[model samples]
Target chain A: MPQCSNCQFQNMPGTTHCGRCGASLLLATALIDVHPPRATRWSKTWRKSRFWHIWHSLNHLSADLARRVDVSYPSSWPSILAAVRLIVPGWPQLAGSKVNLGRFLLGGYLSCGLLAAVCYGTTIGSFFIAVAITIHSIGLYDVAQSSSKVRAVRISRILLGCGLIGLFLYLPLFNLVPQYAAPFAIRVNREPLRVGDVLLSNRNAYVWARPRVGDIVLYELNPVRVPAFEQGRNAVLNLAGQRVDRVLAVPGQSIVCDGRTLTVDGQPSPHRPLNLTFSSLQVSLIVPPDHYFIIPSGERIDGLLPNNENIVRTLSLIPITQIEGRVYWRNYPWSRMGRIR
Target chain B: MARFRKLELGKGLPGDSNPDGPSGNEQAGCLELAVEQRRCGNYENALRLYSRALEDDKSLVTGWLGQVQMLIMLDESVEAELWSRKALELFPGNGDLLAGRAQAFRRMGDKGQALLLSDGALKSAGQSAYRWMVRGELMIVIGQETHLHCFDKAVQIDQDWLVPLEIALIYRDLGAPSRALGRIRRTVELAPDRYYAWFVQGQVERDLGLEAAAIKSWRHCLELCHGHVDAERELAQLEAGGWSVGRVWRRLFGNR
Candidate 1:
C-alpha cells in the first residue's frame, strides 16, 4: 500500500501522489516505506521497479556519500558510485583522478601469490593466487564495460602506480620512507633521535636477540588484561603510551641512577664516547626475565627529570615477546624525513 | 578439586517470552517467526536472529526480550540485565520486560532487588505462571522458609506447573523428606500431564524403597520430557545397578 509522506495515510500501491496533501507518494509506491517518519526528509526519485535494491545499495551505502541521520537524501550518481566502492575498493575516493589503483591489487595479489607458490612450493599459495586471478578477471570485465575514461581511470592509475611502488618498496633508499610517514618526532644532533616522537619497533630487527644498549626501540605500553581462558592468544593490544629509548639494561642486570651518574649491574655504564648520553638520577631498576633496558640519548646527558620531560638516560629492558612488526621508514613532511636509525 | 560452579536461572530475553517482537518494519512477520521458534524451544537461533534484527534497528524491541531468554540460556545475567534496561527505555510500562530484568538481577545474586522488581512486575499484572515462578525462586535464594508459599503461588498462578513440583524437592535441606513428598503428590494431583510431577513422584517412591515403581514413574517422565538432562542422569545412575536405598540416602543428604 502507498502511504503519504506528510500525513499518515495509506492508499493503493500504484498511487504516485497523496490523495489529500498531494505530497509525493513515489517513495511509498517505489520504496514501499508505507509508514515513513514525517520528520525525515523524503527522496523524490522513487520508482516501483524490481531493481530498486540495486539502486538502494549503490546510493544509500556509498562510502563517498556522507551519512546524515537528518534531512538529506542520496543522489543517483553518488549512490551508484557508493556501491562500486565496495566491489572495487578505493573507487569512491579515487574515482575522478587520473589514477587507476584497481589494476595493481587484484593482479598484483595474483602475481605475488603465484610467485610465492612457485618459490615456496606451497599449494596454499596457489589457491590464494587462484582467488586473486578470479577477482582480477572480474575487475578486468568491469573496466572493459565502463562507458567512459573518467569512470575507469581511478582503477587503472592504481594498478600501474601500485605495481611500480610494490616493485621498488624492498629496494635501497626507497626503504627510508617511514621517517616521512609519522611526523610527530624531531631529530637533534647526530643522534637519529627526536623528541615528541614515537617510533614503531622493527620487530624483524631483533630476530635473534633483543635491541641493544644505545639502540632506540619501540614498545607498546598499553595495559590489556588477557582472560585466563585466552592467556597465550594473539592479542592486537593498542599502544597505551609511547617512548623511544636505547637499551640500558637486560635480564639479570640492575640499574641505579644517583645524582647524574648511572650504574648498570653495580657498575657505571659506558657514557663517555656517546656525548648525548648524559641522563643520571639515582633510582634502582631490576631487569626482569626476557625484557630489555633501553636508554635514550636525551637522558644520557640530563639525569632523570621529575616531570618525565627529560628523555631517560636509561629505559627498561623490553620483553622479546612484546614485539610488533618493525616500521623502518617515515614519509611525511617531505623536507624532514629519513631512515629511523 | 572441582570448584562449585554457580547456579543460574531464567532465560530472560525480549524477543523471548513475548507475543510481539520489538518494533520494526517487518515486525509482524518477524514476530510470528519468533513465536513459532519459542513454541518449538528453538530459543537459541530465535535469539540470534532477534539480536541481528535488533542490530539492524535498535528500535526493534522483539529482539530485546529474545536476547533476555537467550542470555538466561547462556547463563549470562549481567548482559541480560543491561539489555532489560535498554528494553525499558522504549516500552516504559512493559510488565514482561520488568520481570525479565528482575530475573537478571536475581542471577547476579541481588535477590533483594530481584524480589522487588518481581513484585513490581506482578502488581502491573505480569501475573503469568512465569512471573510467579520467578517470585518462588527469589524466595528460595533470599530465604527458603517460603518454599511452600512460593510453590503454592506458582501452582495457583498456573495449576499445571512443571516447576513447582521440582522446587518442592529443595526441602531436603529442611530435613522433611515426607513434606517434600506431600508437595510433589499435590503437584501431581493438579498437573498430571507435566513430566516434573512424574519425576518427583519417582524420587519419592525411590525414597520409600519402591525401586520398580520408581523406575516406572521415571521412565514415564522421560517419555514426556524428551532431553531432560537431570532425569536422564538419574535414570542412567539407577540403570548402572549401583543405586540402592543406602546410595540414594547418602547422595541426597551427603552435602547437608
Candidate 2:
C-alpha cells in the first residue's frame, strides 16, 4: 500500500502516481483502502497511453489477416467470403480472377449512370447516375489486380455501361415512366419524418394547398439549377443526401414561439423555438378541415401568428389542402437515423 | 437549448442576405434562399438567413440581394440601393439587381431614371433572352421605342413560347383574338409543357366560337397542367352549357 506523498490518494503497491491527481505515491506507506472502491474515475481509468486499446484492435486485425492467410486456402475453406474474393454476384462461374473487381465497378457505374440517364434525362437523372457510378468505381479500384479475369469483367462492365448510355440517348423514344406516377401518393421528400416535424414545401407537390404546420410531408423542391451534390462532390449518395426542412403547424392553435421555446396549442413539443429572431415569428393557425398544420417542433412562438406580416406569418395560417405528406423515415447516420420519432 | 436544436431549422425564413462576403447565385441552395425571403417581404428572416448563409459561402449573391431587399422593405431603400449596388458590383450585369433597382426607382418616384436604366439594361442585354423578355415587359407597360426591337429579338432568339406569350398578351389586351390565336398556337408548340399555352389556345378557340375546340383545349390543359382554376371554370361552363358575358370577362382578364 502506498499513499501519495502530496495528495490524500492512496494506491496499491508499485503505483507511481496518485490515481486521483497524478501526485507521487512512492514515499508514504499507508492504508490502501480509503473508501469502498468505486469504478475508477473516467480520468483515472486510462492513465497511460491507451496502447492496450490500439494493441487490441491491431491484434484483432492481425487475427483476421492470419485467418485468411491460408496454407491451402482453395482446398480448405469453401466459404462465401473466400469465394467473393474471386467472384461477385451474377457472374459466370469461370476461373475467378482478382482483377475482375475493377471491371465490375466500372460496369456498375456506367450501367447505373446510363440507366439513370435513360430514366431521368441529363438534367436530373443522368447527372445523378454518373455520380453514383463513379462512387462504385472507387471500390472496384481497390479490388483490381490487373489479371485477365479482371480484364474480362471490365469489358463486361463497359458493355453494360454502354447499353445504359444508349438507353439514355434514346430515352424519349423509349420513355418507360410517365410524366406522373401514381395519381396521388403520400410520398414525403423528408424521410423519417418525425411526429411533429415539418419540411420545406416541395414546389413539386399538390395543386392548391400551401404547406402548413402539422402536416407531415414529403418535401421535394424544384430541381435546383445547380444541385447541392453537383459541383461540390464526386459521390452520388452525397448529392442525394441534400434535403430541405419541413414544419407542421396547426391553424387557430395558439402557437407561440418565445425566442428559444415553442408551444403548440399549449403543448410543448420536443423541438423548441430557434432564437434567431423572436420579433418576426407567429405560429397561430386554425387547422384547416381534414388537414392538420404539420408543424415541426419549433416553428411557432407566443404572439407569433402567420397573418402578422412577419417571417412566422405563414405559421399562423395553414390550409388543410397544403399538407403535403407525413414524414415516415430518416435515411441518414444509419444508427440514430431511422423512422421519424 | 436542447429543444431548439431541432426547431432551429423550422424558424428560419427562406431568404437571407449577406451583402459583404460573396456572390449568392453562384453558391446555390437554401444558402441562396435569403433573397427570395426578401422578395417575399420577410425582412427579419431575410437578415437572419443572410448572416447564416454568409457563414457558408460568403460570396453568395442572394445573401446580399436579400439584405438589400430587406433594407428596402424596411423603408431603408437608400441603404438597400447601396447594398444592391454592392451586389451589382459582384455580378456586374445581374438581371435581378437591375430589376431590383428598377423597382427601387419606381418606389422612389424616379420614373424617368428608372425607365432609362431599364432601357439601358435591355439594350446592353440584347443577346440575353430573359433580358429581352424583361425589357419587352417594361416597354409594353410604357410604350417605349424598344418594344418592336425587344419583342422581335426575344422571338428570334428562341420564341420558345415566351415571345408568342408576350404577343398573345398584347393581342388579348388589344381585343384581337385572331392575332392572339396565331401567337398562342406557336406558343403551344414552343412550350408544350406549359398549361398556360394550352389555356391560351382554349381562350382563342372560345373567342372564335369554336366551343368544341375550346372545351377540348381546356380539358387538355387541365389534364396536362392540373389544378388550373381557369381551366376548371371553362370546363364547368362547357359542361353547364351556359357561358355568360361576365364569365367571359373574368375568363379573359380576372381569371387569367
Candidate 3:
C-alpha cells in the first residue's frame, strides 16, 4: 500500500493518484518511508545487522563483571520503597487528578526524557541525566509493583506504547518532520543570540510572503561546508545545517560590506562587519531575487561571505527556498521565551 | 621524521617507497586513476582510491590533495579541512596543502585565516591554476577591486571550462549579469552539451530579467539533464509569475 503525501490515506498499489484527494501519488510510491510502519522497519534492519550478537556479547560481559564484583541486589523492596519515597511529592497531585498510575508514570517518563533532550546541548548535562534516571527508576518501580494496575499490562505492550509516544515527541522536538515547528538551540554566543538560547522556528510560515530584511530566520546549509574551529568547539548543533542568522538584505536589495559596515542601497546600515581580513575585506552585490543575505547576529562575519560564496550559497546569502522558516519566537531558558523580533 | 626521510629515499614502508617492492610510482598511479574517476563523475570511487593511495604512502602530497578535492566536491568541507590539517602536520609549508587548507577555511567561513593562508600559498609554491583560483576567491573576500585579474590569470594558466564558470558566478554575485552572461556564454561554447552550463546560463538570464531567454535556457538544461531540480524549480517559478494580473492581485491581497 502507498500512503498519500497529501492526505496520508492508504491507497491501492500502482495507484497513480490518491483516492482521498486525487493528488499525485508518485512521491509516496517512490519514497517508501513516507508512512513507515511503527516498528517493523526497525526489527527488519536489526535482523540484518550484527545487533543481536553485539547485544549478547555486552550482556555476557556485564553478567561476568557482575559475578566478579559479587554485588547483590540488596533487597529489591528497599530500592522500590526508596523510589516511591522519591515520588511522594507528586503522589498527592496524582491522587487528586484521578488519572491512572500507568498514565502518571508515562507522563513522568516523557517529561524527564524531554528535559534531558532539551538540556543535552548545554553545560548542565549531568543534572538532566540524574533527573531522568531518577524518574526512570520510579517508573520501573511502578511497573514492578504487583498492586499497581500498570503491572497487569503486558511489559512488551507497555514498552511499545511508551516507545511510540517517545518517537512522536522526538519527531517535532528534533525538527525531523518535513514541515516542522520546533525549537532551535543557539550555538554561537553572539550579541543578539546567546549560546543555549532556544528559538522556535515555524518552517511553514513563509508559504505566502517573501522574507523581509531584519527578519531573523532559521536557514539551513551543509554544516561540513560552513567554517568553524576544528576542535569541535563552536561545532554546529545541527550537523545538517548552519546556525541561525539575521536577514540584512532581501531579494533585489543592493548591499555592500566594505569590511567595516554594511551599506544597503547606498546608506550605511546599522549592521557591522564581525569577521574580516585584509586580503578579503570588501563585498558588494545586488541580492538576487529568491535569495537573501543572512548573517549571524554580531560584530563577526560568516566565513563564507568573503571567499567561498560562489561555491556555497549559504555562506553569505541563502536561497529563499532553502530557508526552514522564520524564527518568530524564542521558547527556552525561561528568561527569553517570547517573540524574538 | 626518519620514517619520512627513509620513505623519501624510496626504501621503507610496505607497498610504499620500497623500490624492490610495490614502488612509489603506485601512489602517483593511484592519484591519476582517482582523478580520472573524478572526471567521469565517479566521486565515491575516486574518494576510495584516493584514501587507498594515501594509506599506502602517507607522504603522497597529491594523494592528500586529491582526497580533499574530492571531499570538497562532495560538500564535505569539514572532513576536507580535517584531512588538509592532518596532511599539513606532516608536510608543512607545501603550497598545495596551504591552498587546499585555504579553500577549506573559506568554505568553513573563516575568511581572515583563509586570506592569510592563501597569501602564504601564493608566495610559498603555488603556480597551478587551481592555486590562482583560490587566490581570486580570497581577493574577492578581502574587498579587492581587481579580483577579476586573479581569475583571468587562472584562465591564462589553464583554459579549463570550470574556471570561467566560477568567474561568471563571481560576476553574478557582484551584480553584473551582463558580464556573467558573457562568461557563461563562453562556458556553453566550451562545453556545449553540459547541462550545468545551461542551468547557470538560465540563472544569469533570469537575473538580467530576460524571462523568455531564461525559460529557453532552462528548457535546454532540462533536455540535457532530465528532471534537474534547480531547472525545474526555476521553470515553475517563471511559469507561476507569467500571469501578471493574478500575481499583482496575489501581492496586493495575500495569496491565501
Of the candidates numbered 1 and 2, which has the greater lDDT value? 1
Off by over 4 Å in 3: A1-341, B1-60, B70-78, B169-179, B223-233, B240-256
Q: Is candidate 2 or candidate 3 better by lDDT?
A: 3
Per-residue lDDT tens digits for candidate 3, residues A76-107, read 22232333323332342242222256356557
- The top-ranked prediction according to TM-score is 3
Q: How many clashes in each candidate?
A: 69, 74, 18
lDDT of 1 by residue, A109-187 (tens): 5576556433221344346655655554444344433533564555664464335333543233235533322223434
lDDT of 1 at B126: 40
Chain A TM-score of candidate 3 vs. true chain A: 0.43
DockQ of each: 0.01, 0.00, 0.01
Model 1: per-residue Cα lDDT over B1-256, one tens digit each: 2454454546544444345544454555455566556433355556666654554354443466667755654455655676676566445545667778898777655665687788887786345655665676676676666755766776777664444554454443333556667777777777677676787778777776666667777888888889867678877767567657765775678621
User: How much is the lDDT of residue A46 in candidate 1?
Assistant: 31
Docking class of 2: incorrect
The single-chain TM-score for chain B of candidate 1 is 0.54
Clashes of 2: 74
Q: What is the TM-score of each candidate against the true structure?
A: 0.33, 0.27, 0.36
State the lDDT of candidate 2 residue by residue for A1-341, as single tens digits: 77543334468888766575454443222222111111134423442237634754564455456556654564432333332332332221112222255455556656776666434422345466656545443443333323225566666644544354345533543343322221122233323333323222233344554544433354332221121233566322111112223454543455555435567778875542222243334444444544443332222232433334433333323344444444444332234434442
